[model samples]
Target: MSNNLFKDLVSSVEQAGVEVNHEALQVAKDKLAMKSIIIRVISILGSLLGLGLFIGFIALAASDIFQEAIAFILMGVLFLGGAFALNRSNDGAITVSIAVSLYIIGYAFLSYGLSNDGHLMGYSMFVIALITLFLYNNHIISFLSSLSILVAIHFIMFDLDIQTFYYIYLAIVLAATTYLFWQEQRLRTMDNLIGHRYLPIFAALFTYTLVTGIISSTQQFGYYYFSEFRGVRLFFITVLVAALLFTVHLVLDKMKVSKLPIQIATYLLVIIFNVLVAYYYPAFGIACLFILWGFMRQFKAGFAVGIATLVWAMGMFYYDLGVSLLAKSISLMIVGAMFLAIYYLIQKKGEKHDNI
Candidate 1:
């Protein structure tokens, strides 16, 4: 009886172990099946979205009916498709191809729209390009979109009075594009591309400002024949300032002397020069101050100098109101002292933290 009981106990233990193993295996299989189903579903959905976007993009390029509406639709599809593709694939070639295709389609639609006369298609194209640029993560697409938008703007305002609104618009666009190109070049360490990208943009802005200045002087100020010449002179001065500042920046960057002390010294020197020049030759002083401030690196001293220069410029050029130079001097001294106090406080706090 004892032997029979022990054998039954052993059999029961073996059966229980087998059951647990079977259950675990079944659970793992179920999980795997579930995962496979999910993957298949996602793949199908992605493919379908991609197909739909391709069709929409083609339709926009082919049809001219309500171009802006078509553009919006195309943009929506591309955005969805791009998101899906990026999530689904780690393939660089695929991502680049999709980006290029979307960009080309966007460009085609924009070009067609802008080519049509008497249509606010130019503005529409600009909006579309901006949307495409924002939606797509591809660098190529972003560059192309920016270029297309710029071209569309030029075409739209070809015959219009550029001085009325285009000047500000051009300045903003040029600045933004220049910054973008700068960032890209910095990231890639591509000096050649940087030069190519920024030079034309700078030239365009300089030319526009110069031409507008001339036209405004002649047409509005009744300078008549010399308005054009005056515009040329203004343009040359603007160019000179820009070139000088840019050269200074290049030298500083090459020297790698971007430390706080050097920067502060630069600001001090610039401020002193501007003040002395203003005392001697007040006409060019304000412009010099503005150029210097705009080019200087933004630090504590730089900010102070910028504000002081701006106040002096406004006083000299915009307002004929005379102020007590002593009062101005006192105010600036107080500001400088306050800044020093703050800096000392920050330094003390840092030291205390370091000690702890």
Candidate 2:
């Protein structure tokens, strides 16, 4: 009788375990179904939001102010609503998309006001829009916000002096760029993927500066008819600078040079270039020679040689020496030889240090 009771107890325990397993499986299935439903709902909402924005754009283009305003308001509401919903749902993409949509709507409203001769209202709208955009950690939105602010300042605040406006823009851009660079550096140190992604952005910015500088110089000094054509020259210069900088960075990486040295060389070169461009004096060439000497002392042979070549070329082009063209060519050759000798000496020292 006791043996019969033990068998019955074991059977009961096994049955209970099977029941528990079945319940757990059902719970998992329910959770998965809930997730699927949420995903579908978010997708539908996104589609609707996109459709609404498209209709709003059409209304705007038709110059139906009432319709446009209504559409924009609707768009903003939809995005804000979606963002709120997604935050609760723990859907990152939904949250980000909605936030971006809100920013776009704000920008559109600001633009409309500005174009319609409502400068005060436009400026107010833009300021509000920038604040909203800044709350979101999206780079695209941030850049657009900055650009909108710049445009508003340029067009609406016409009373400000051009130089003042230029300086303000420069300061803003520089601050933003420095922040981004610092972020990139931090991410790189942490081995994050985002660290490398900003390279193209930096390249693009440098290109823009180069292109704009060229166009403005050409238009002001080269007697261009319209300011519109200025951008083309600026664009080419931007391309050239981007290409050169990219190459330099690439080579430095391959050579396993420390980033500090590369950065220092870049800074020195930039300062020398700026001084030369600003002064347009023969003495700048002498200053460049001294800068090159400093770089050589720091074991930046490649950079020193590159700067020396640049100075020599610029001098030859700008200075109309009483001497013949042959004399200029001979002088440049001598300068080139000097650079080669210096580079060789530095290379030998570096080699010896490595050997030891």
Candidate 3:
């Protein structure tokens, strides 16, 4: 009986060894496949770049026969056509890069030819973006295309009053994006497979929101167009938007945890804290909302982007504050300490959760 048991144990160990070896072999194969794919992608990018540069040089040399803008537009058309053909052939990386390059060239030509008026460019890019979204469903292409459309619209409407037209446009974008974000979350809660597909779109919109919000708030990038309230009203509107975003987050939190009493108490605390932050450090408040949204949605890119923007906003705030350098330094130190404490708390909580 003892001999039989020993033989069975040895057999089991041998079987486990085989399985482990199989897994390791599979992992190696996967790594090799990934390496090949990366090599191919790099080759494609280099080829495309070389081709683009050659065409650009030819265009420059032939500038007498064809105007610079016309030459660029022609090159853009050729690239766009090539992108469509490559996409049809299922070459994603190169296809998307070509599309992006085409957009860059087209935008440059349009900017130069149209005397900086962006209405035509904006509409053209938006149409192209929609077509690409439907045709390829590529995430990076969609993001850049959407970003171009938004920027073009901004340039097109640069002369509008900030209080009325700009604020209304922003609110519409905010409301639509929030609805899309929540709807995706809701579908995910219901375990719908399609819900995962649109998450990228929402993530892109979050990026767009962060970028446009920051630019408007800081008056960066030569954004001098404003209404009667000018800077004051723009800041107020931003704070209001932040409050609204926080409110949406609160609702999402309640949906997740469903603890009414805790939610109410938390809300009260947030209201008090938010008012002070909104008044004194409005950009920081908006950044916090972005961070919250990113974490809640499990969007790592958004989280990283929010952290970057938060740092920028903080630095800008410190620079612009009308206070003594010593006081400013002290305030920064206090904020740094608070961040450390928060980081420590988060680490502890994560460790506890992991143990559980």
Clash number for every model?
0, 2, 0
- Arranged by TM-score with the best first, the candidates are 3, 2, 1
What tens digits encode model 3's per-residue C-alpha lDDT throughout 36-130?
65654565577658767876697678767455455545655665565556545553455555554554454444444443344466555556555
- After TM-score superposition, the amount by which residue 53's alpha carbon in candidate 2 deviates from its true location, in angstroms, is 7.9
Give lDDT tens digits, candidate 1, residues 64-122. Answer: 64556546555555554654365335424444445455446445544454445546667
* Candidate no. 3 TM-score: 0.63
- Backbone clash pairs for candidate 1 read none
TM-score of each: 0.34, 0.40, 0.63
> Model 1: how large is the Cα RMSD against the reference?
21.1
| lDDT-superior candidate, 2 or 3 | 3
Model 2's C-alpha root-mean-square deviation from the true structure amounts to 16.7
Candidate 2's residue-wise lDDT over 202-242, tens digit each? 43333333233233333233232122444433433333333
The lDDT values for all models are 0.46, 0.45, 0.55
- Model 3 stretches astray by more than 4 angstroms: 1-48, 68-73, 92-120, 127-132, 159-164, 185-200, 219-226, 230-265, 272-282, 322-356
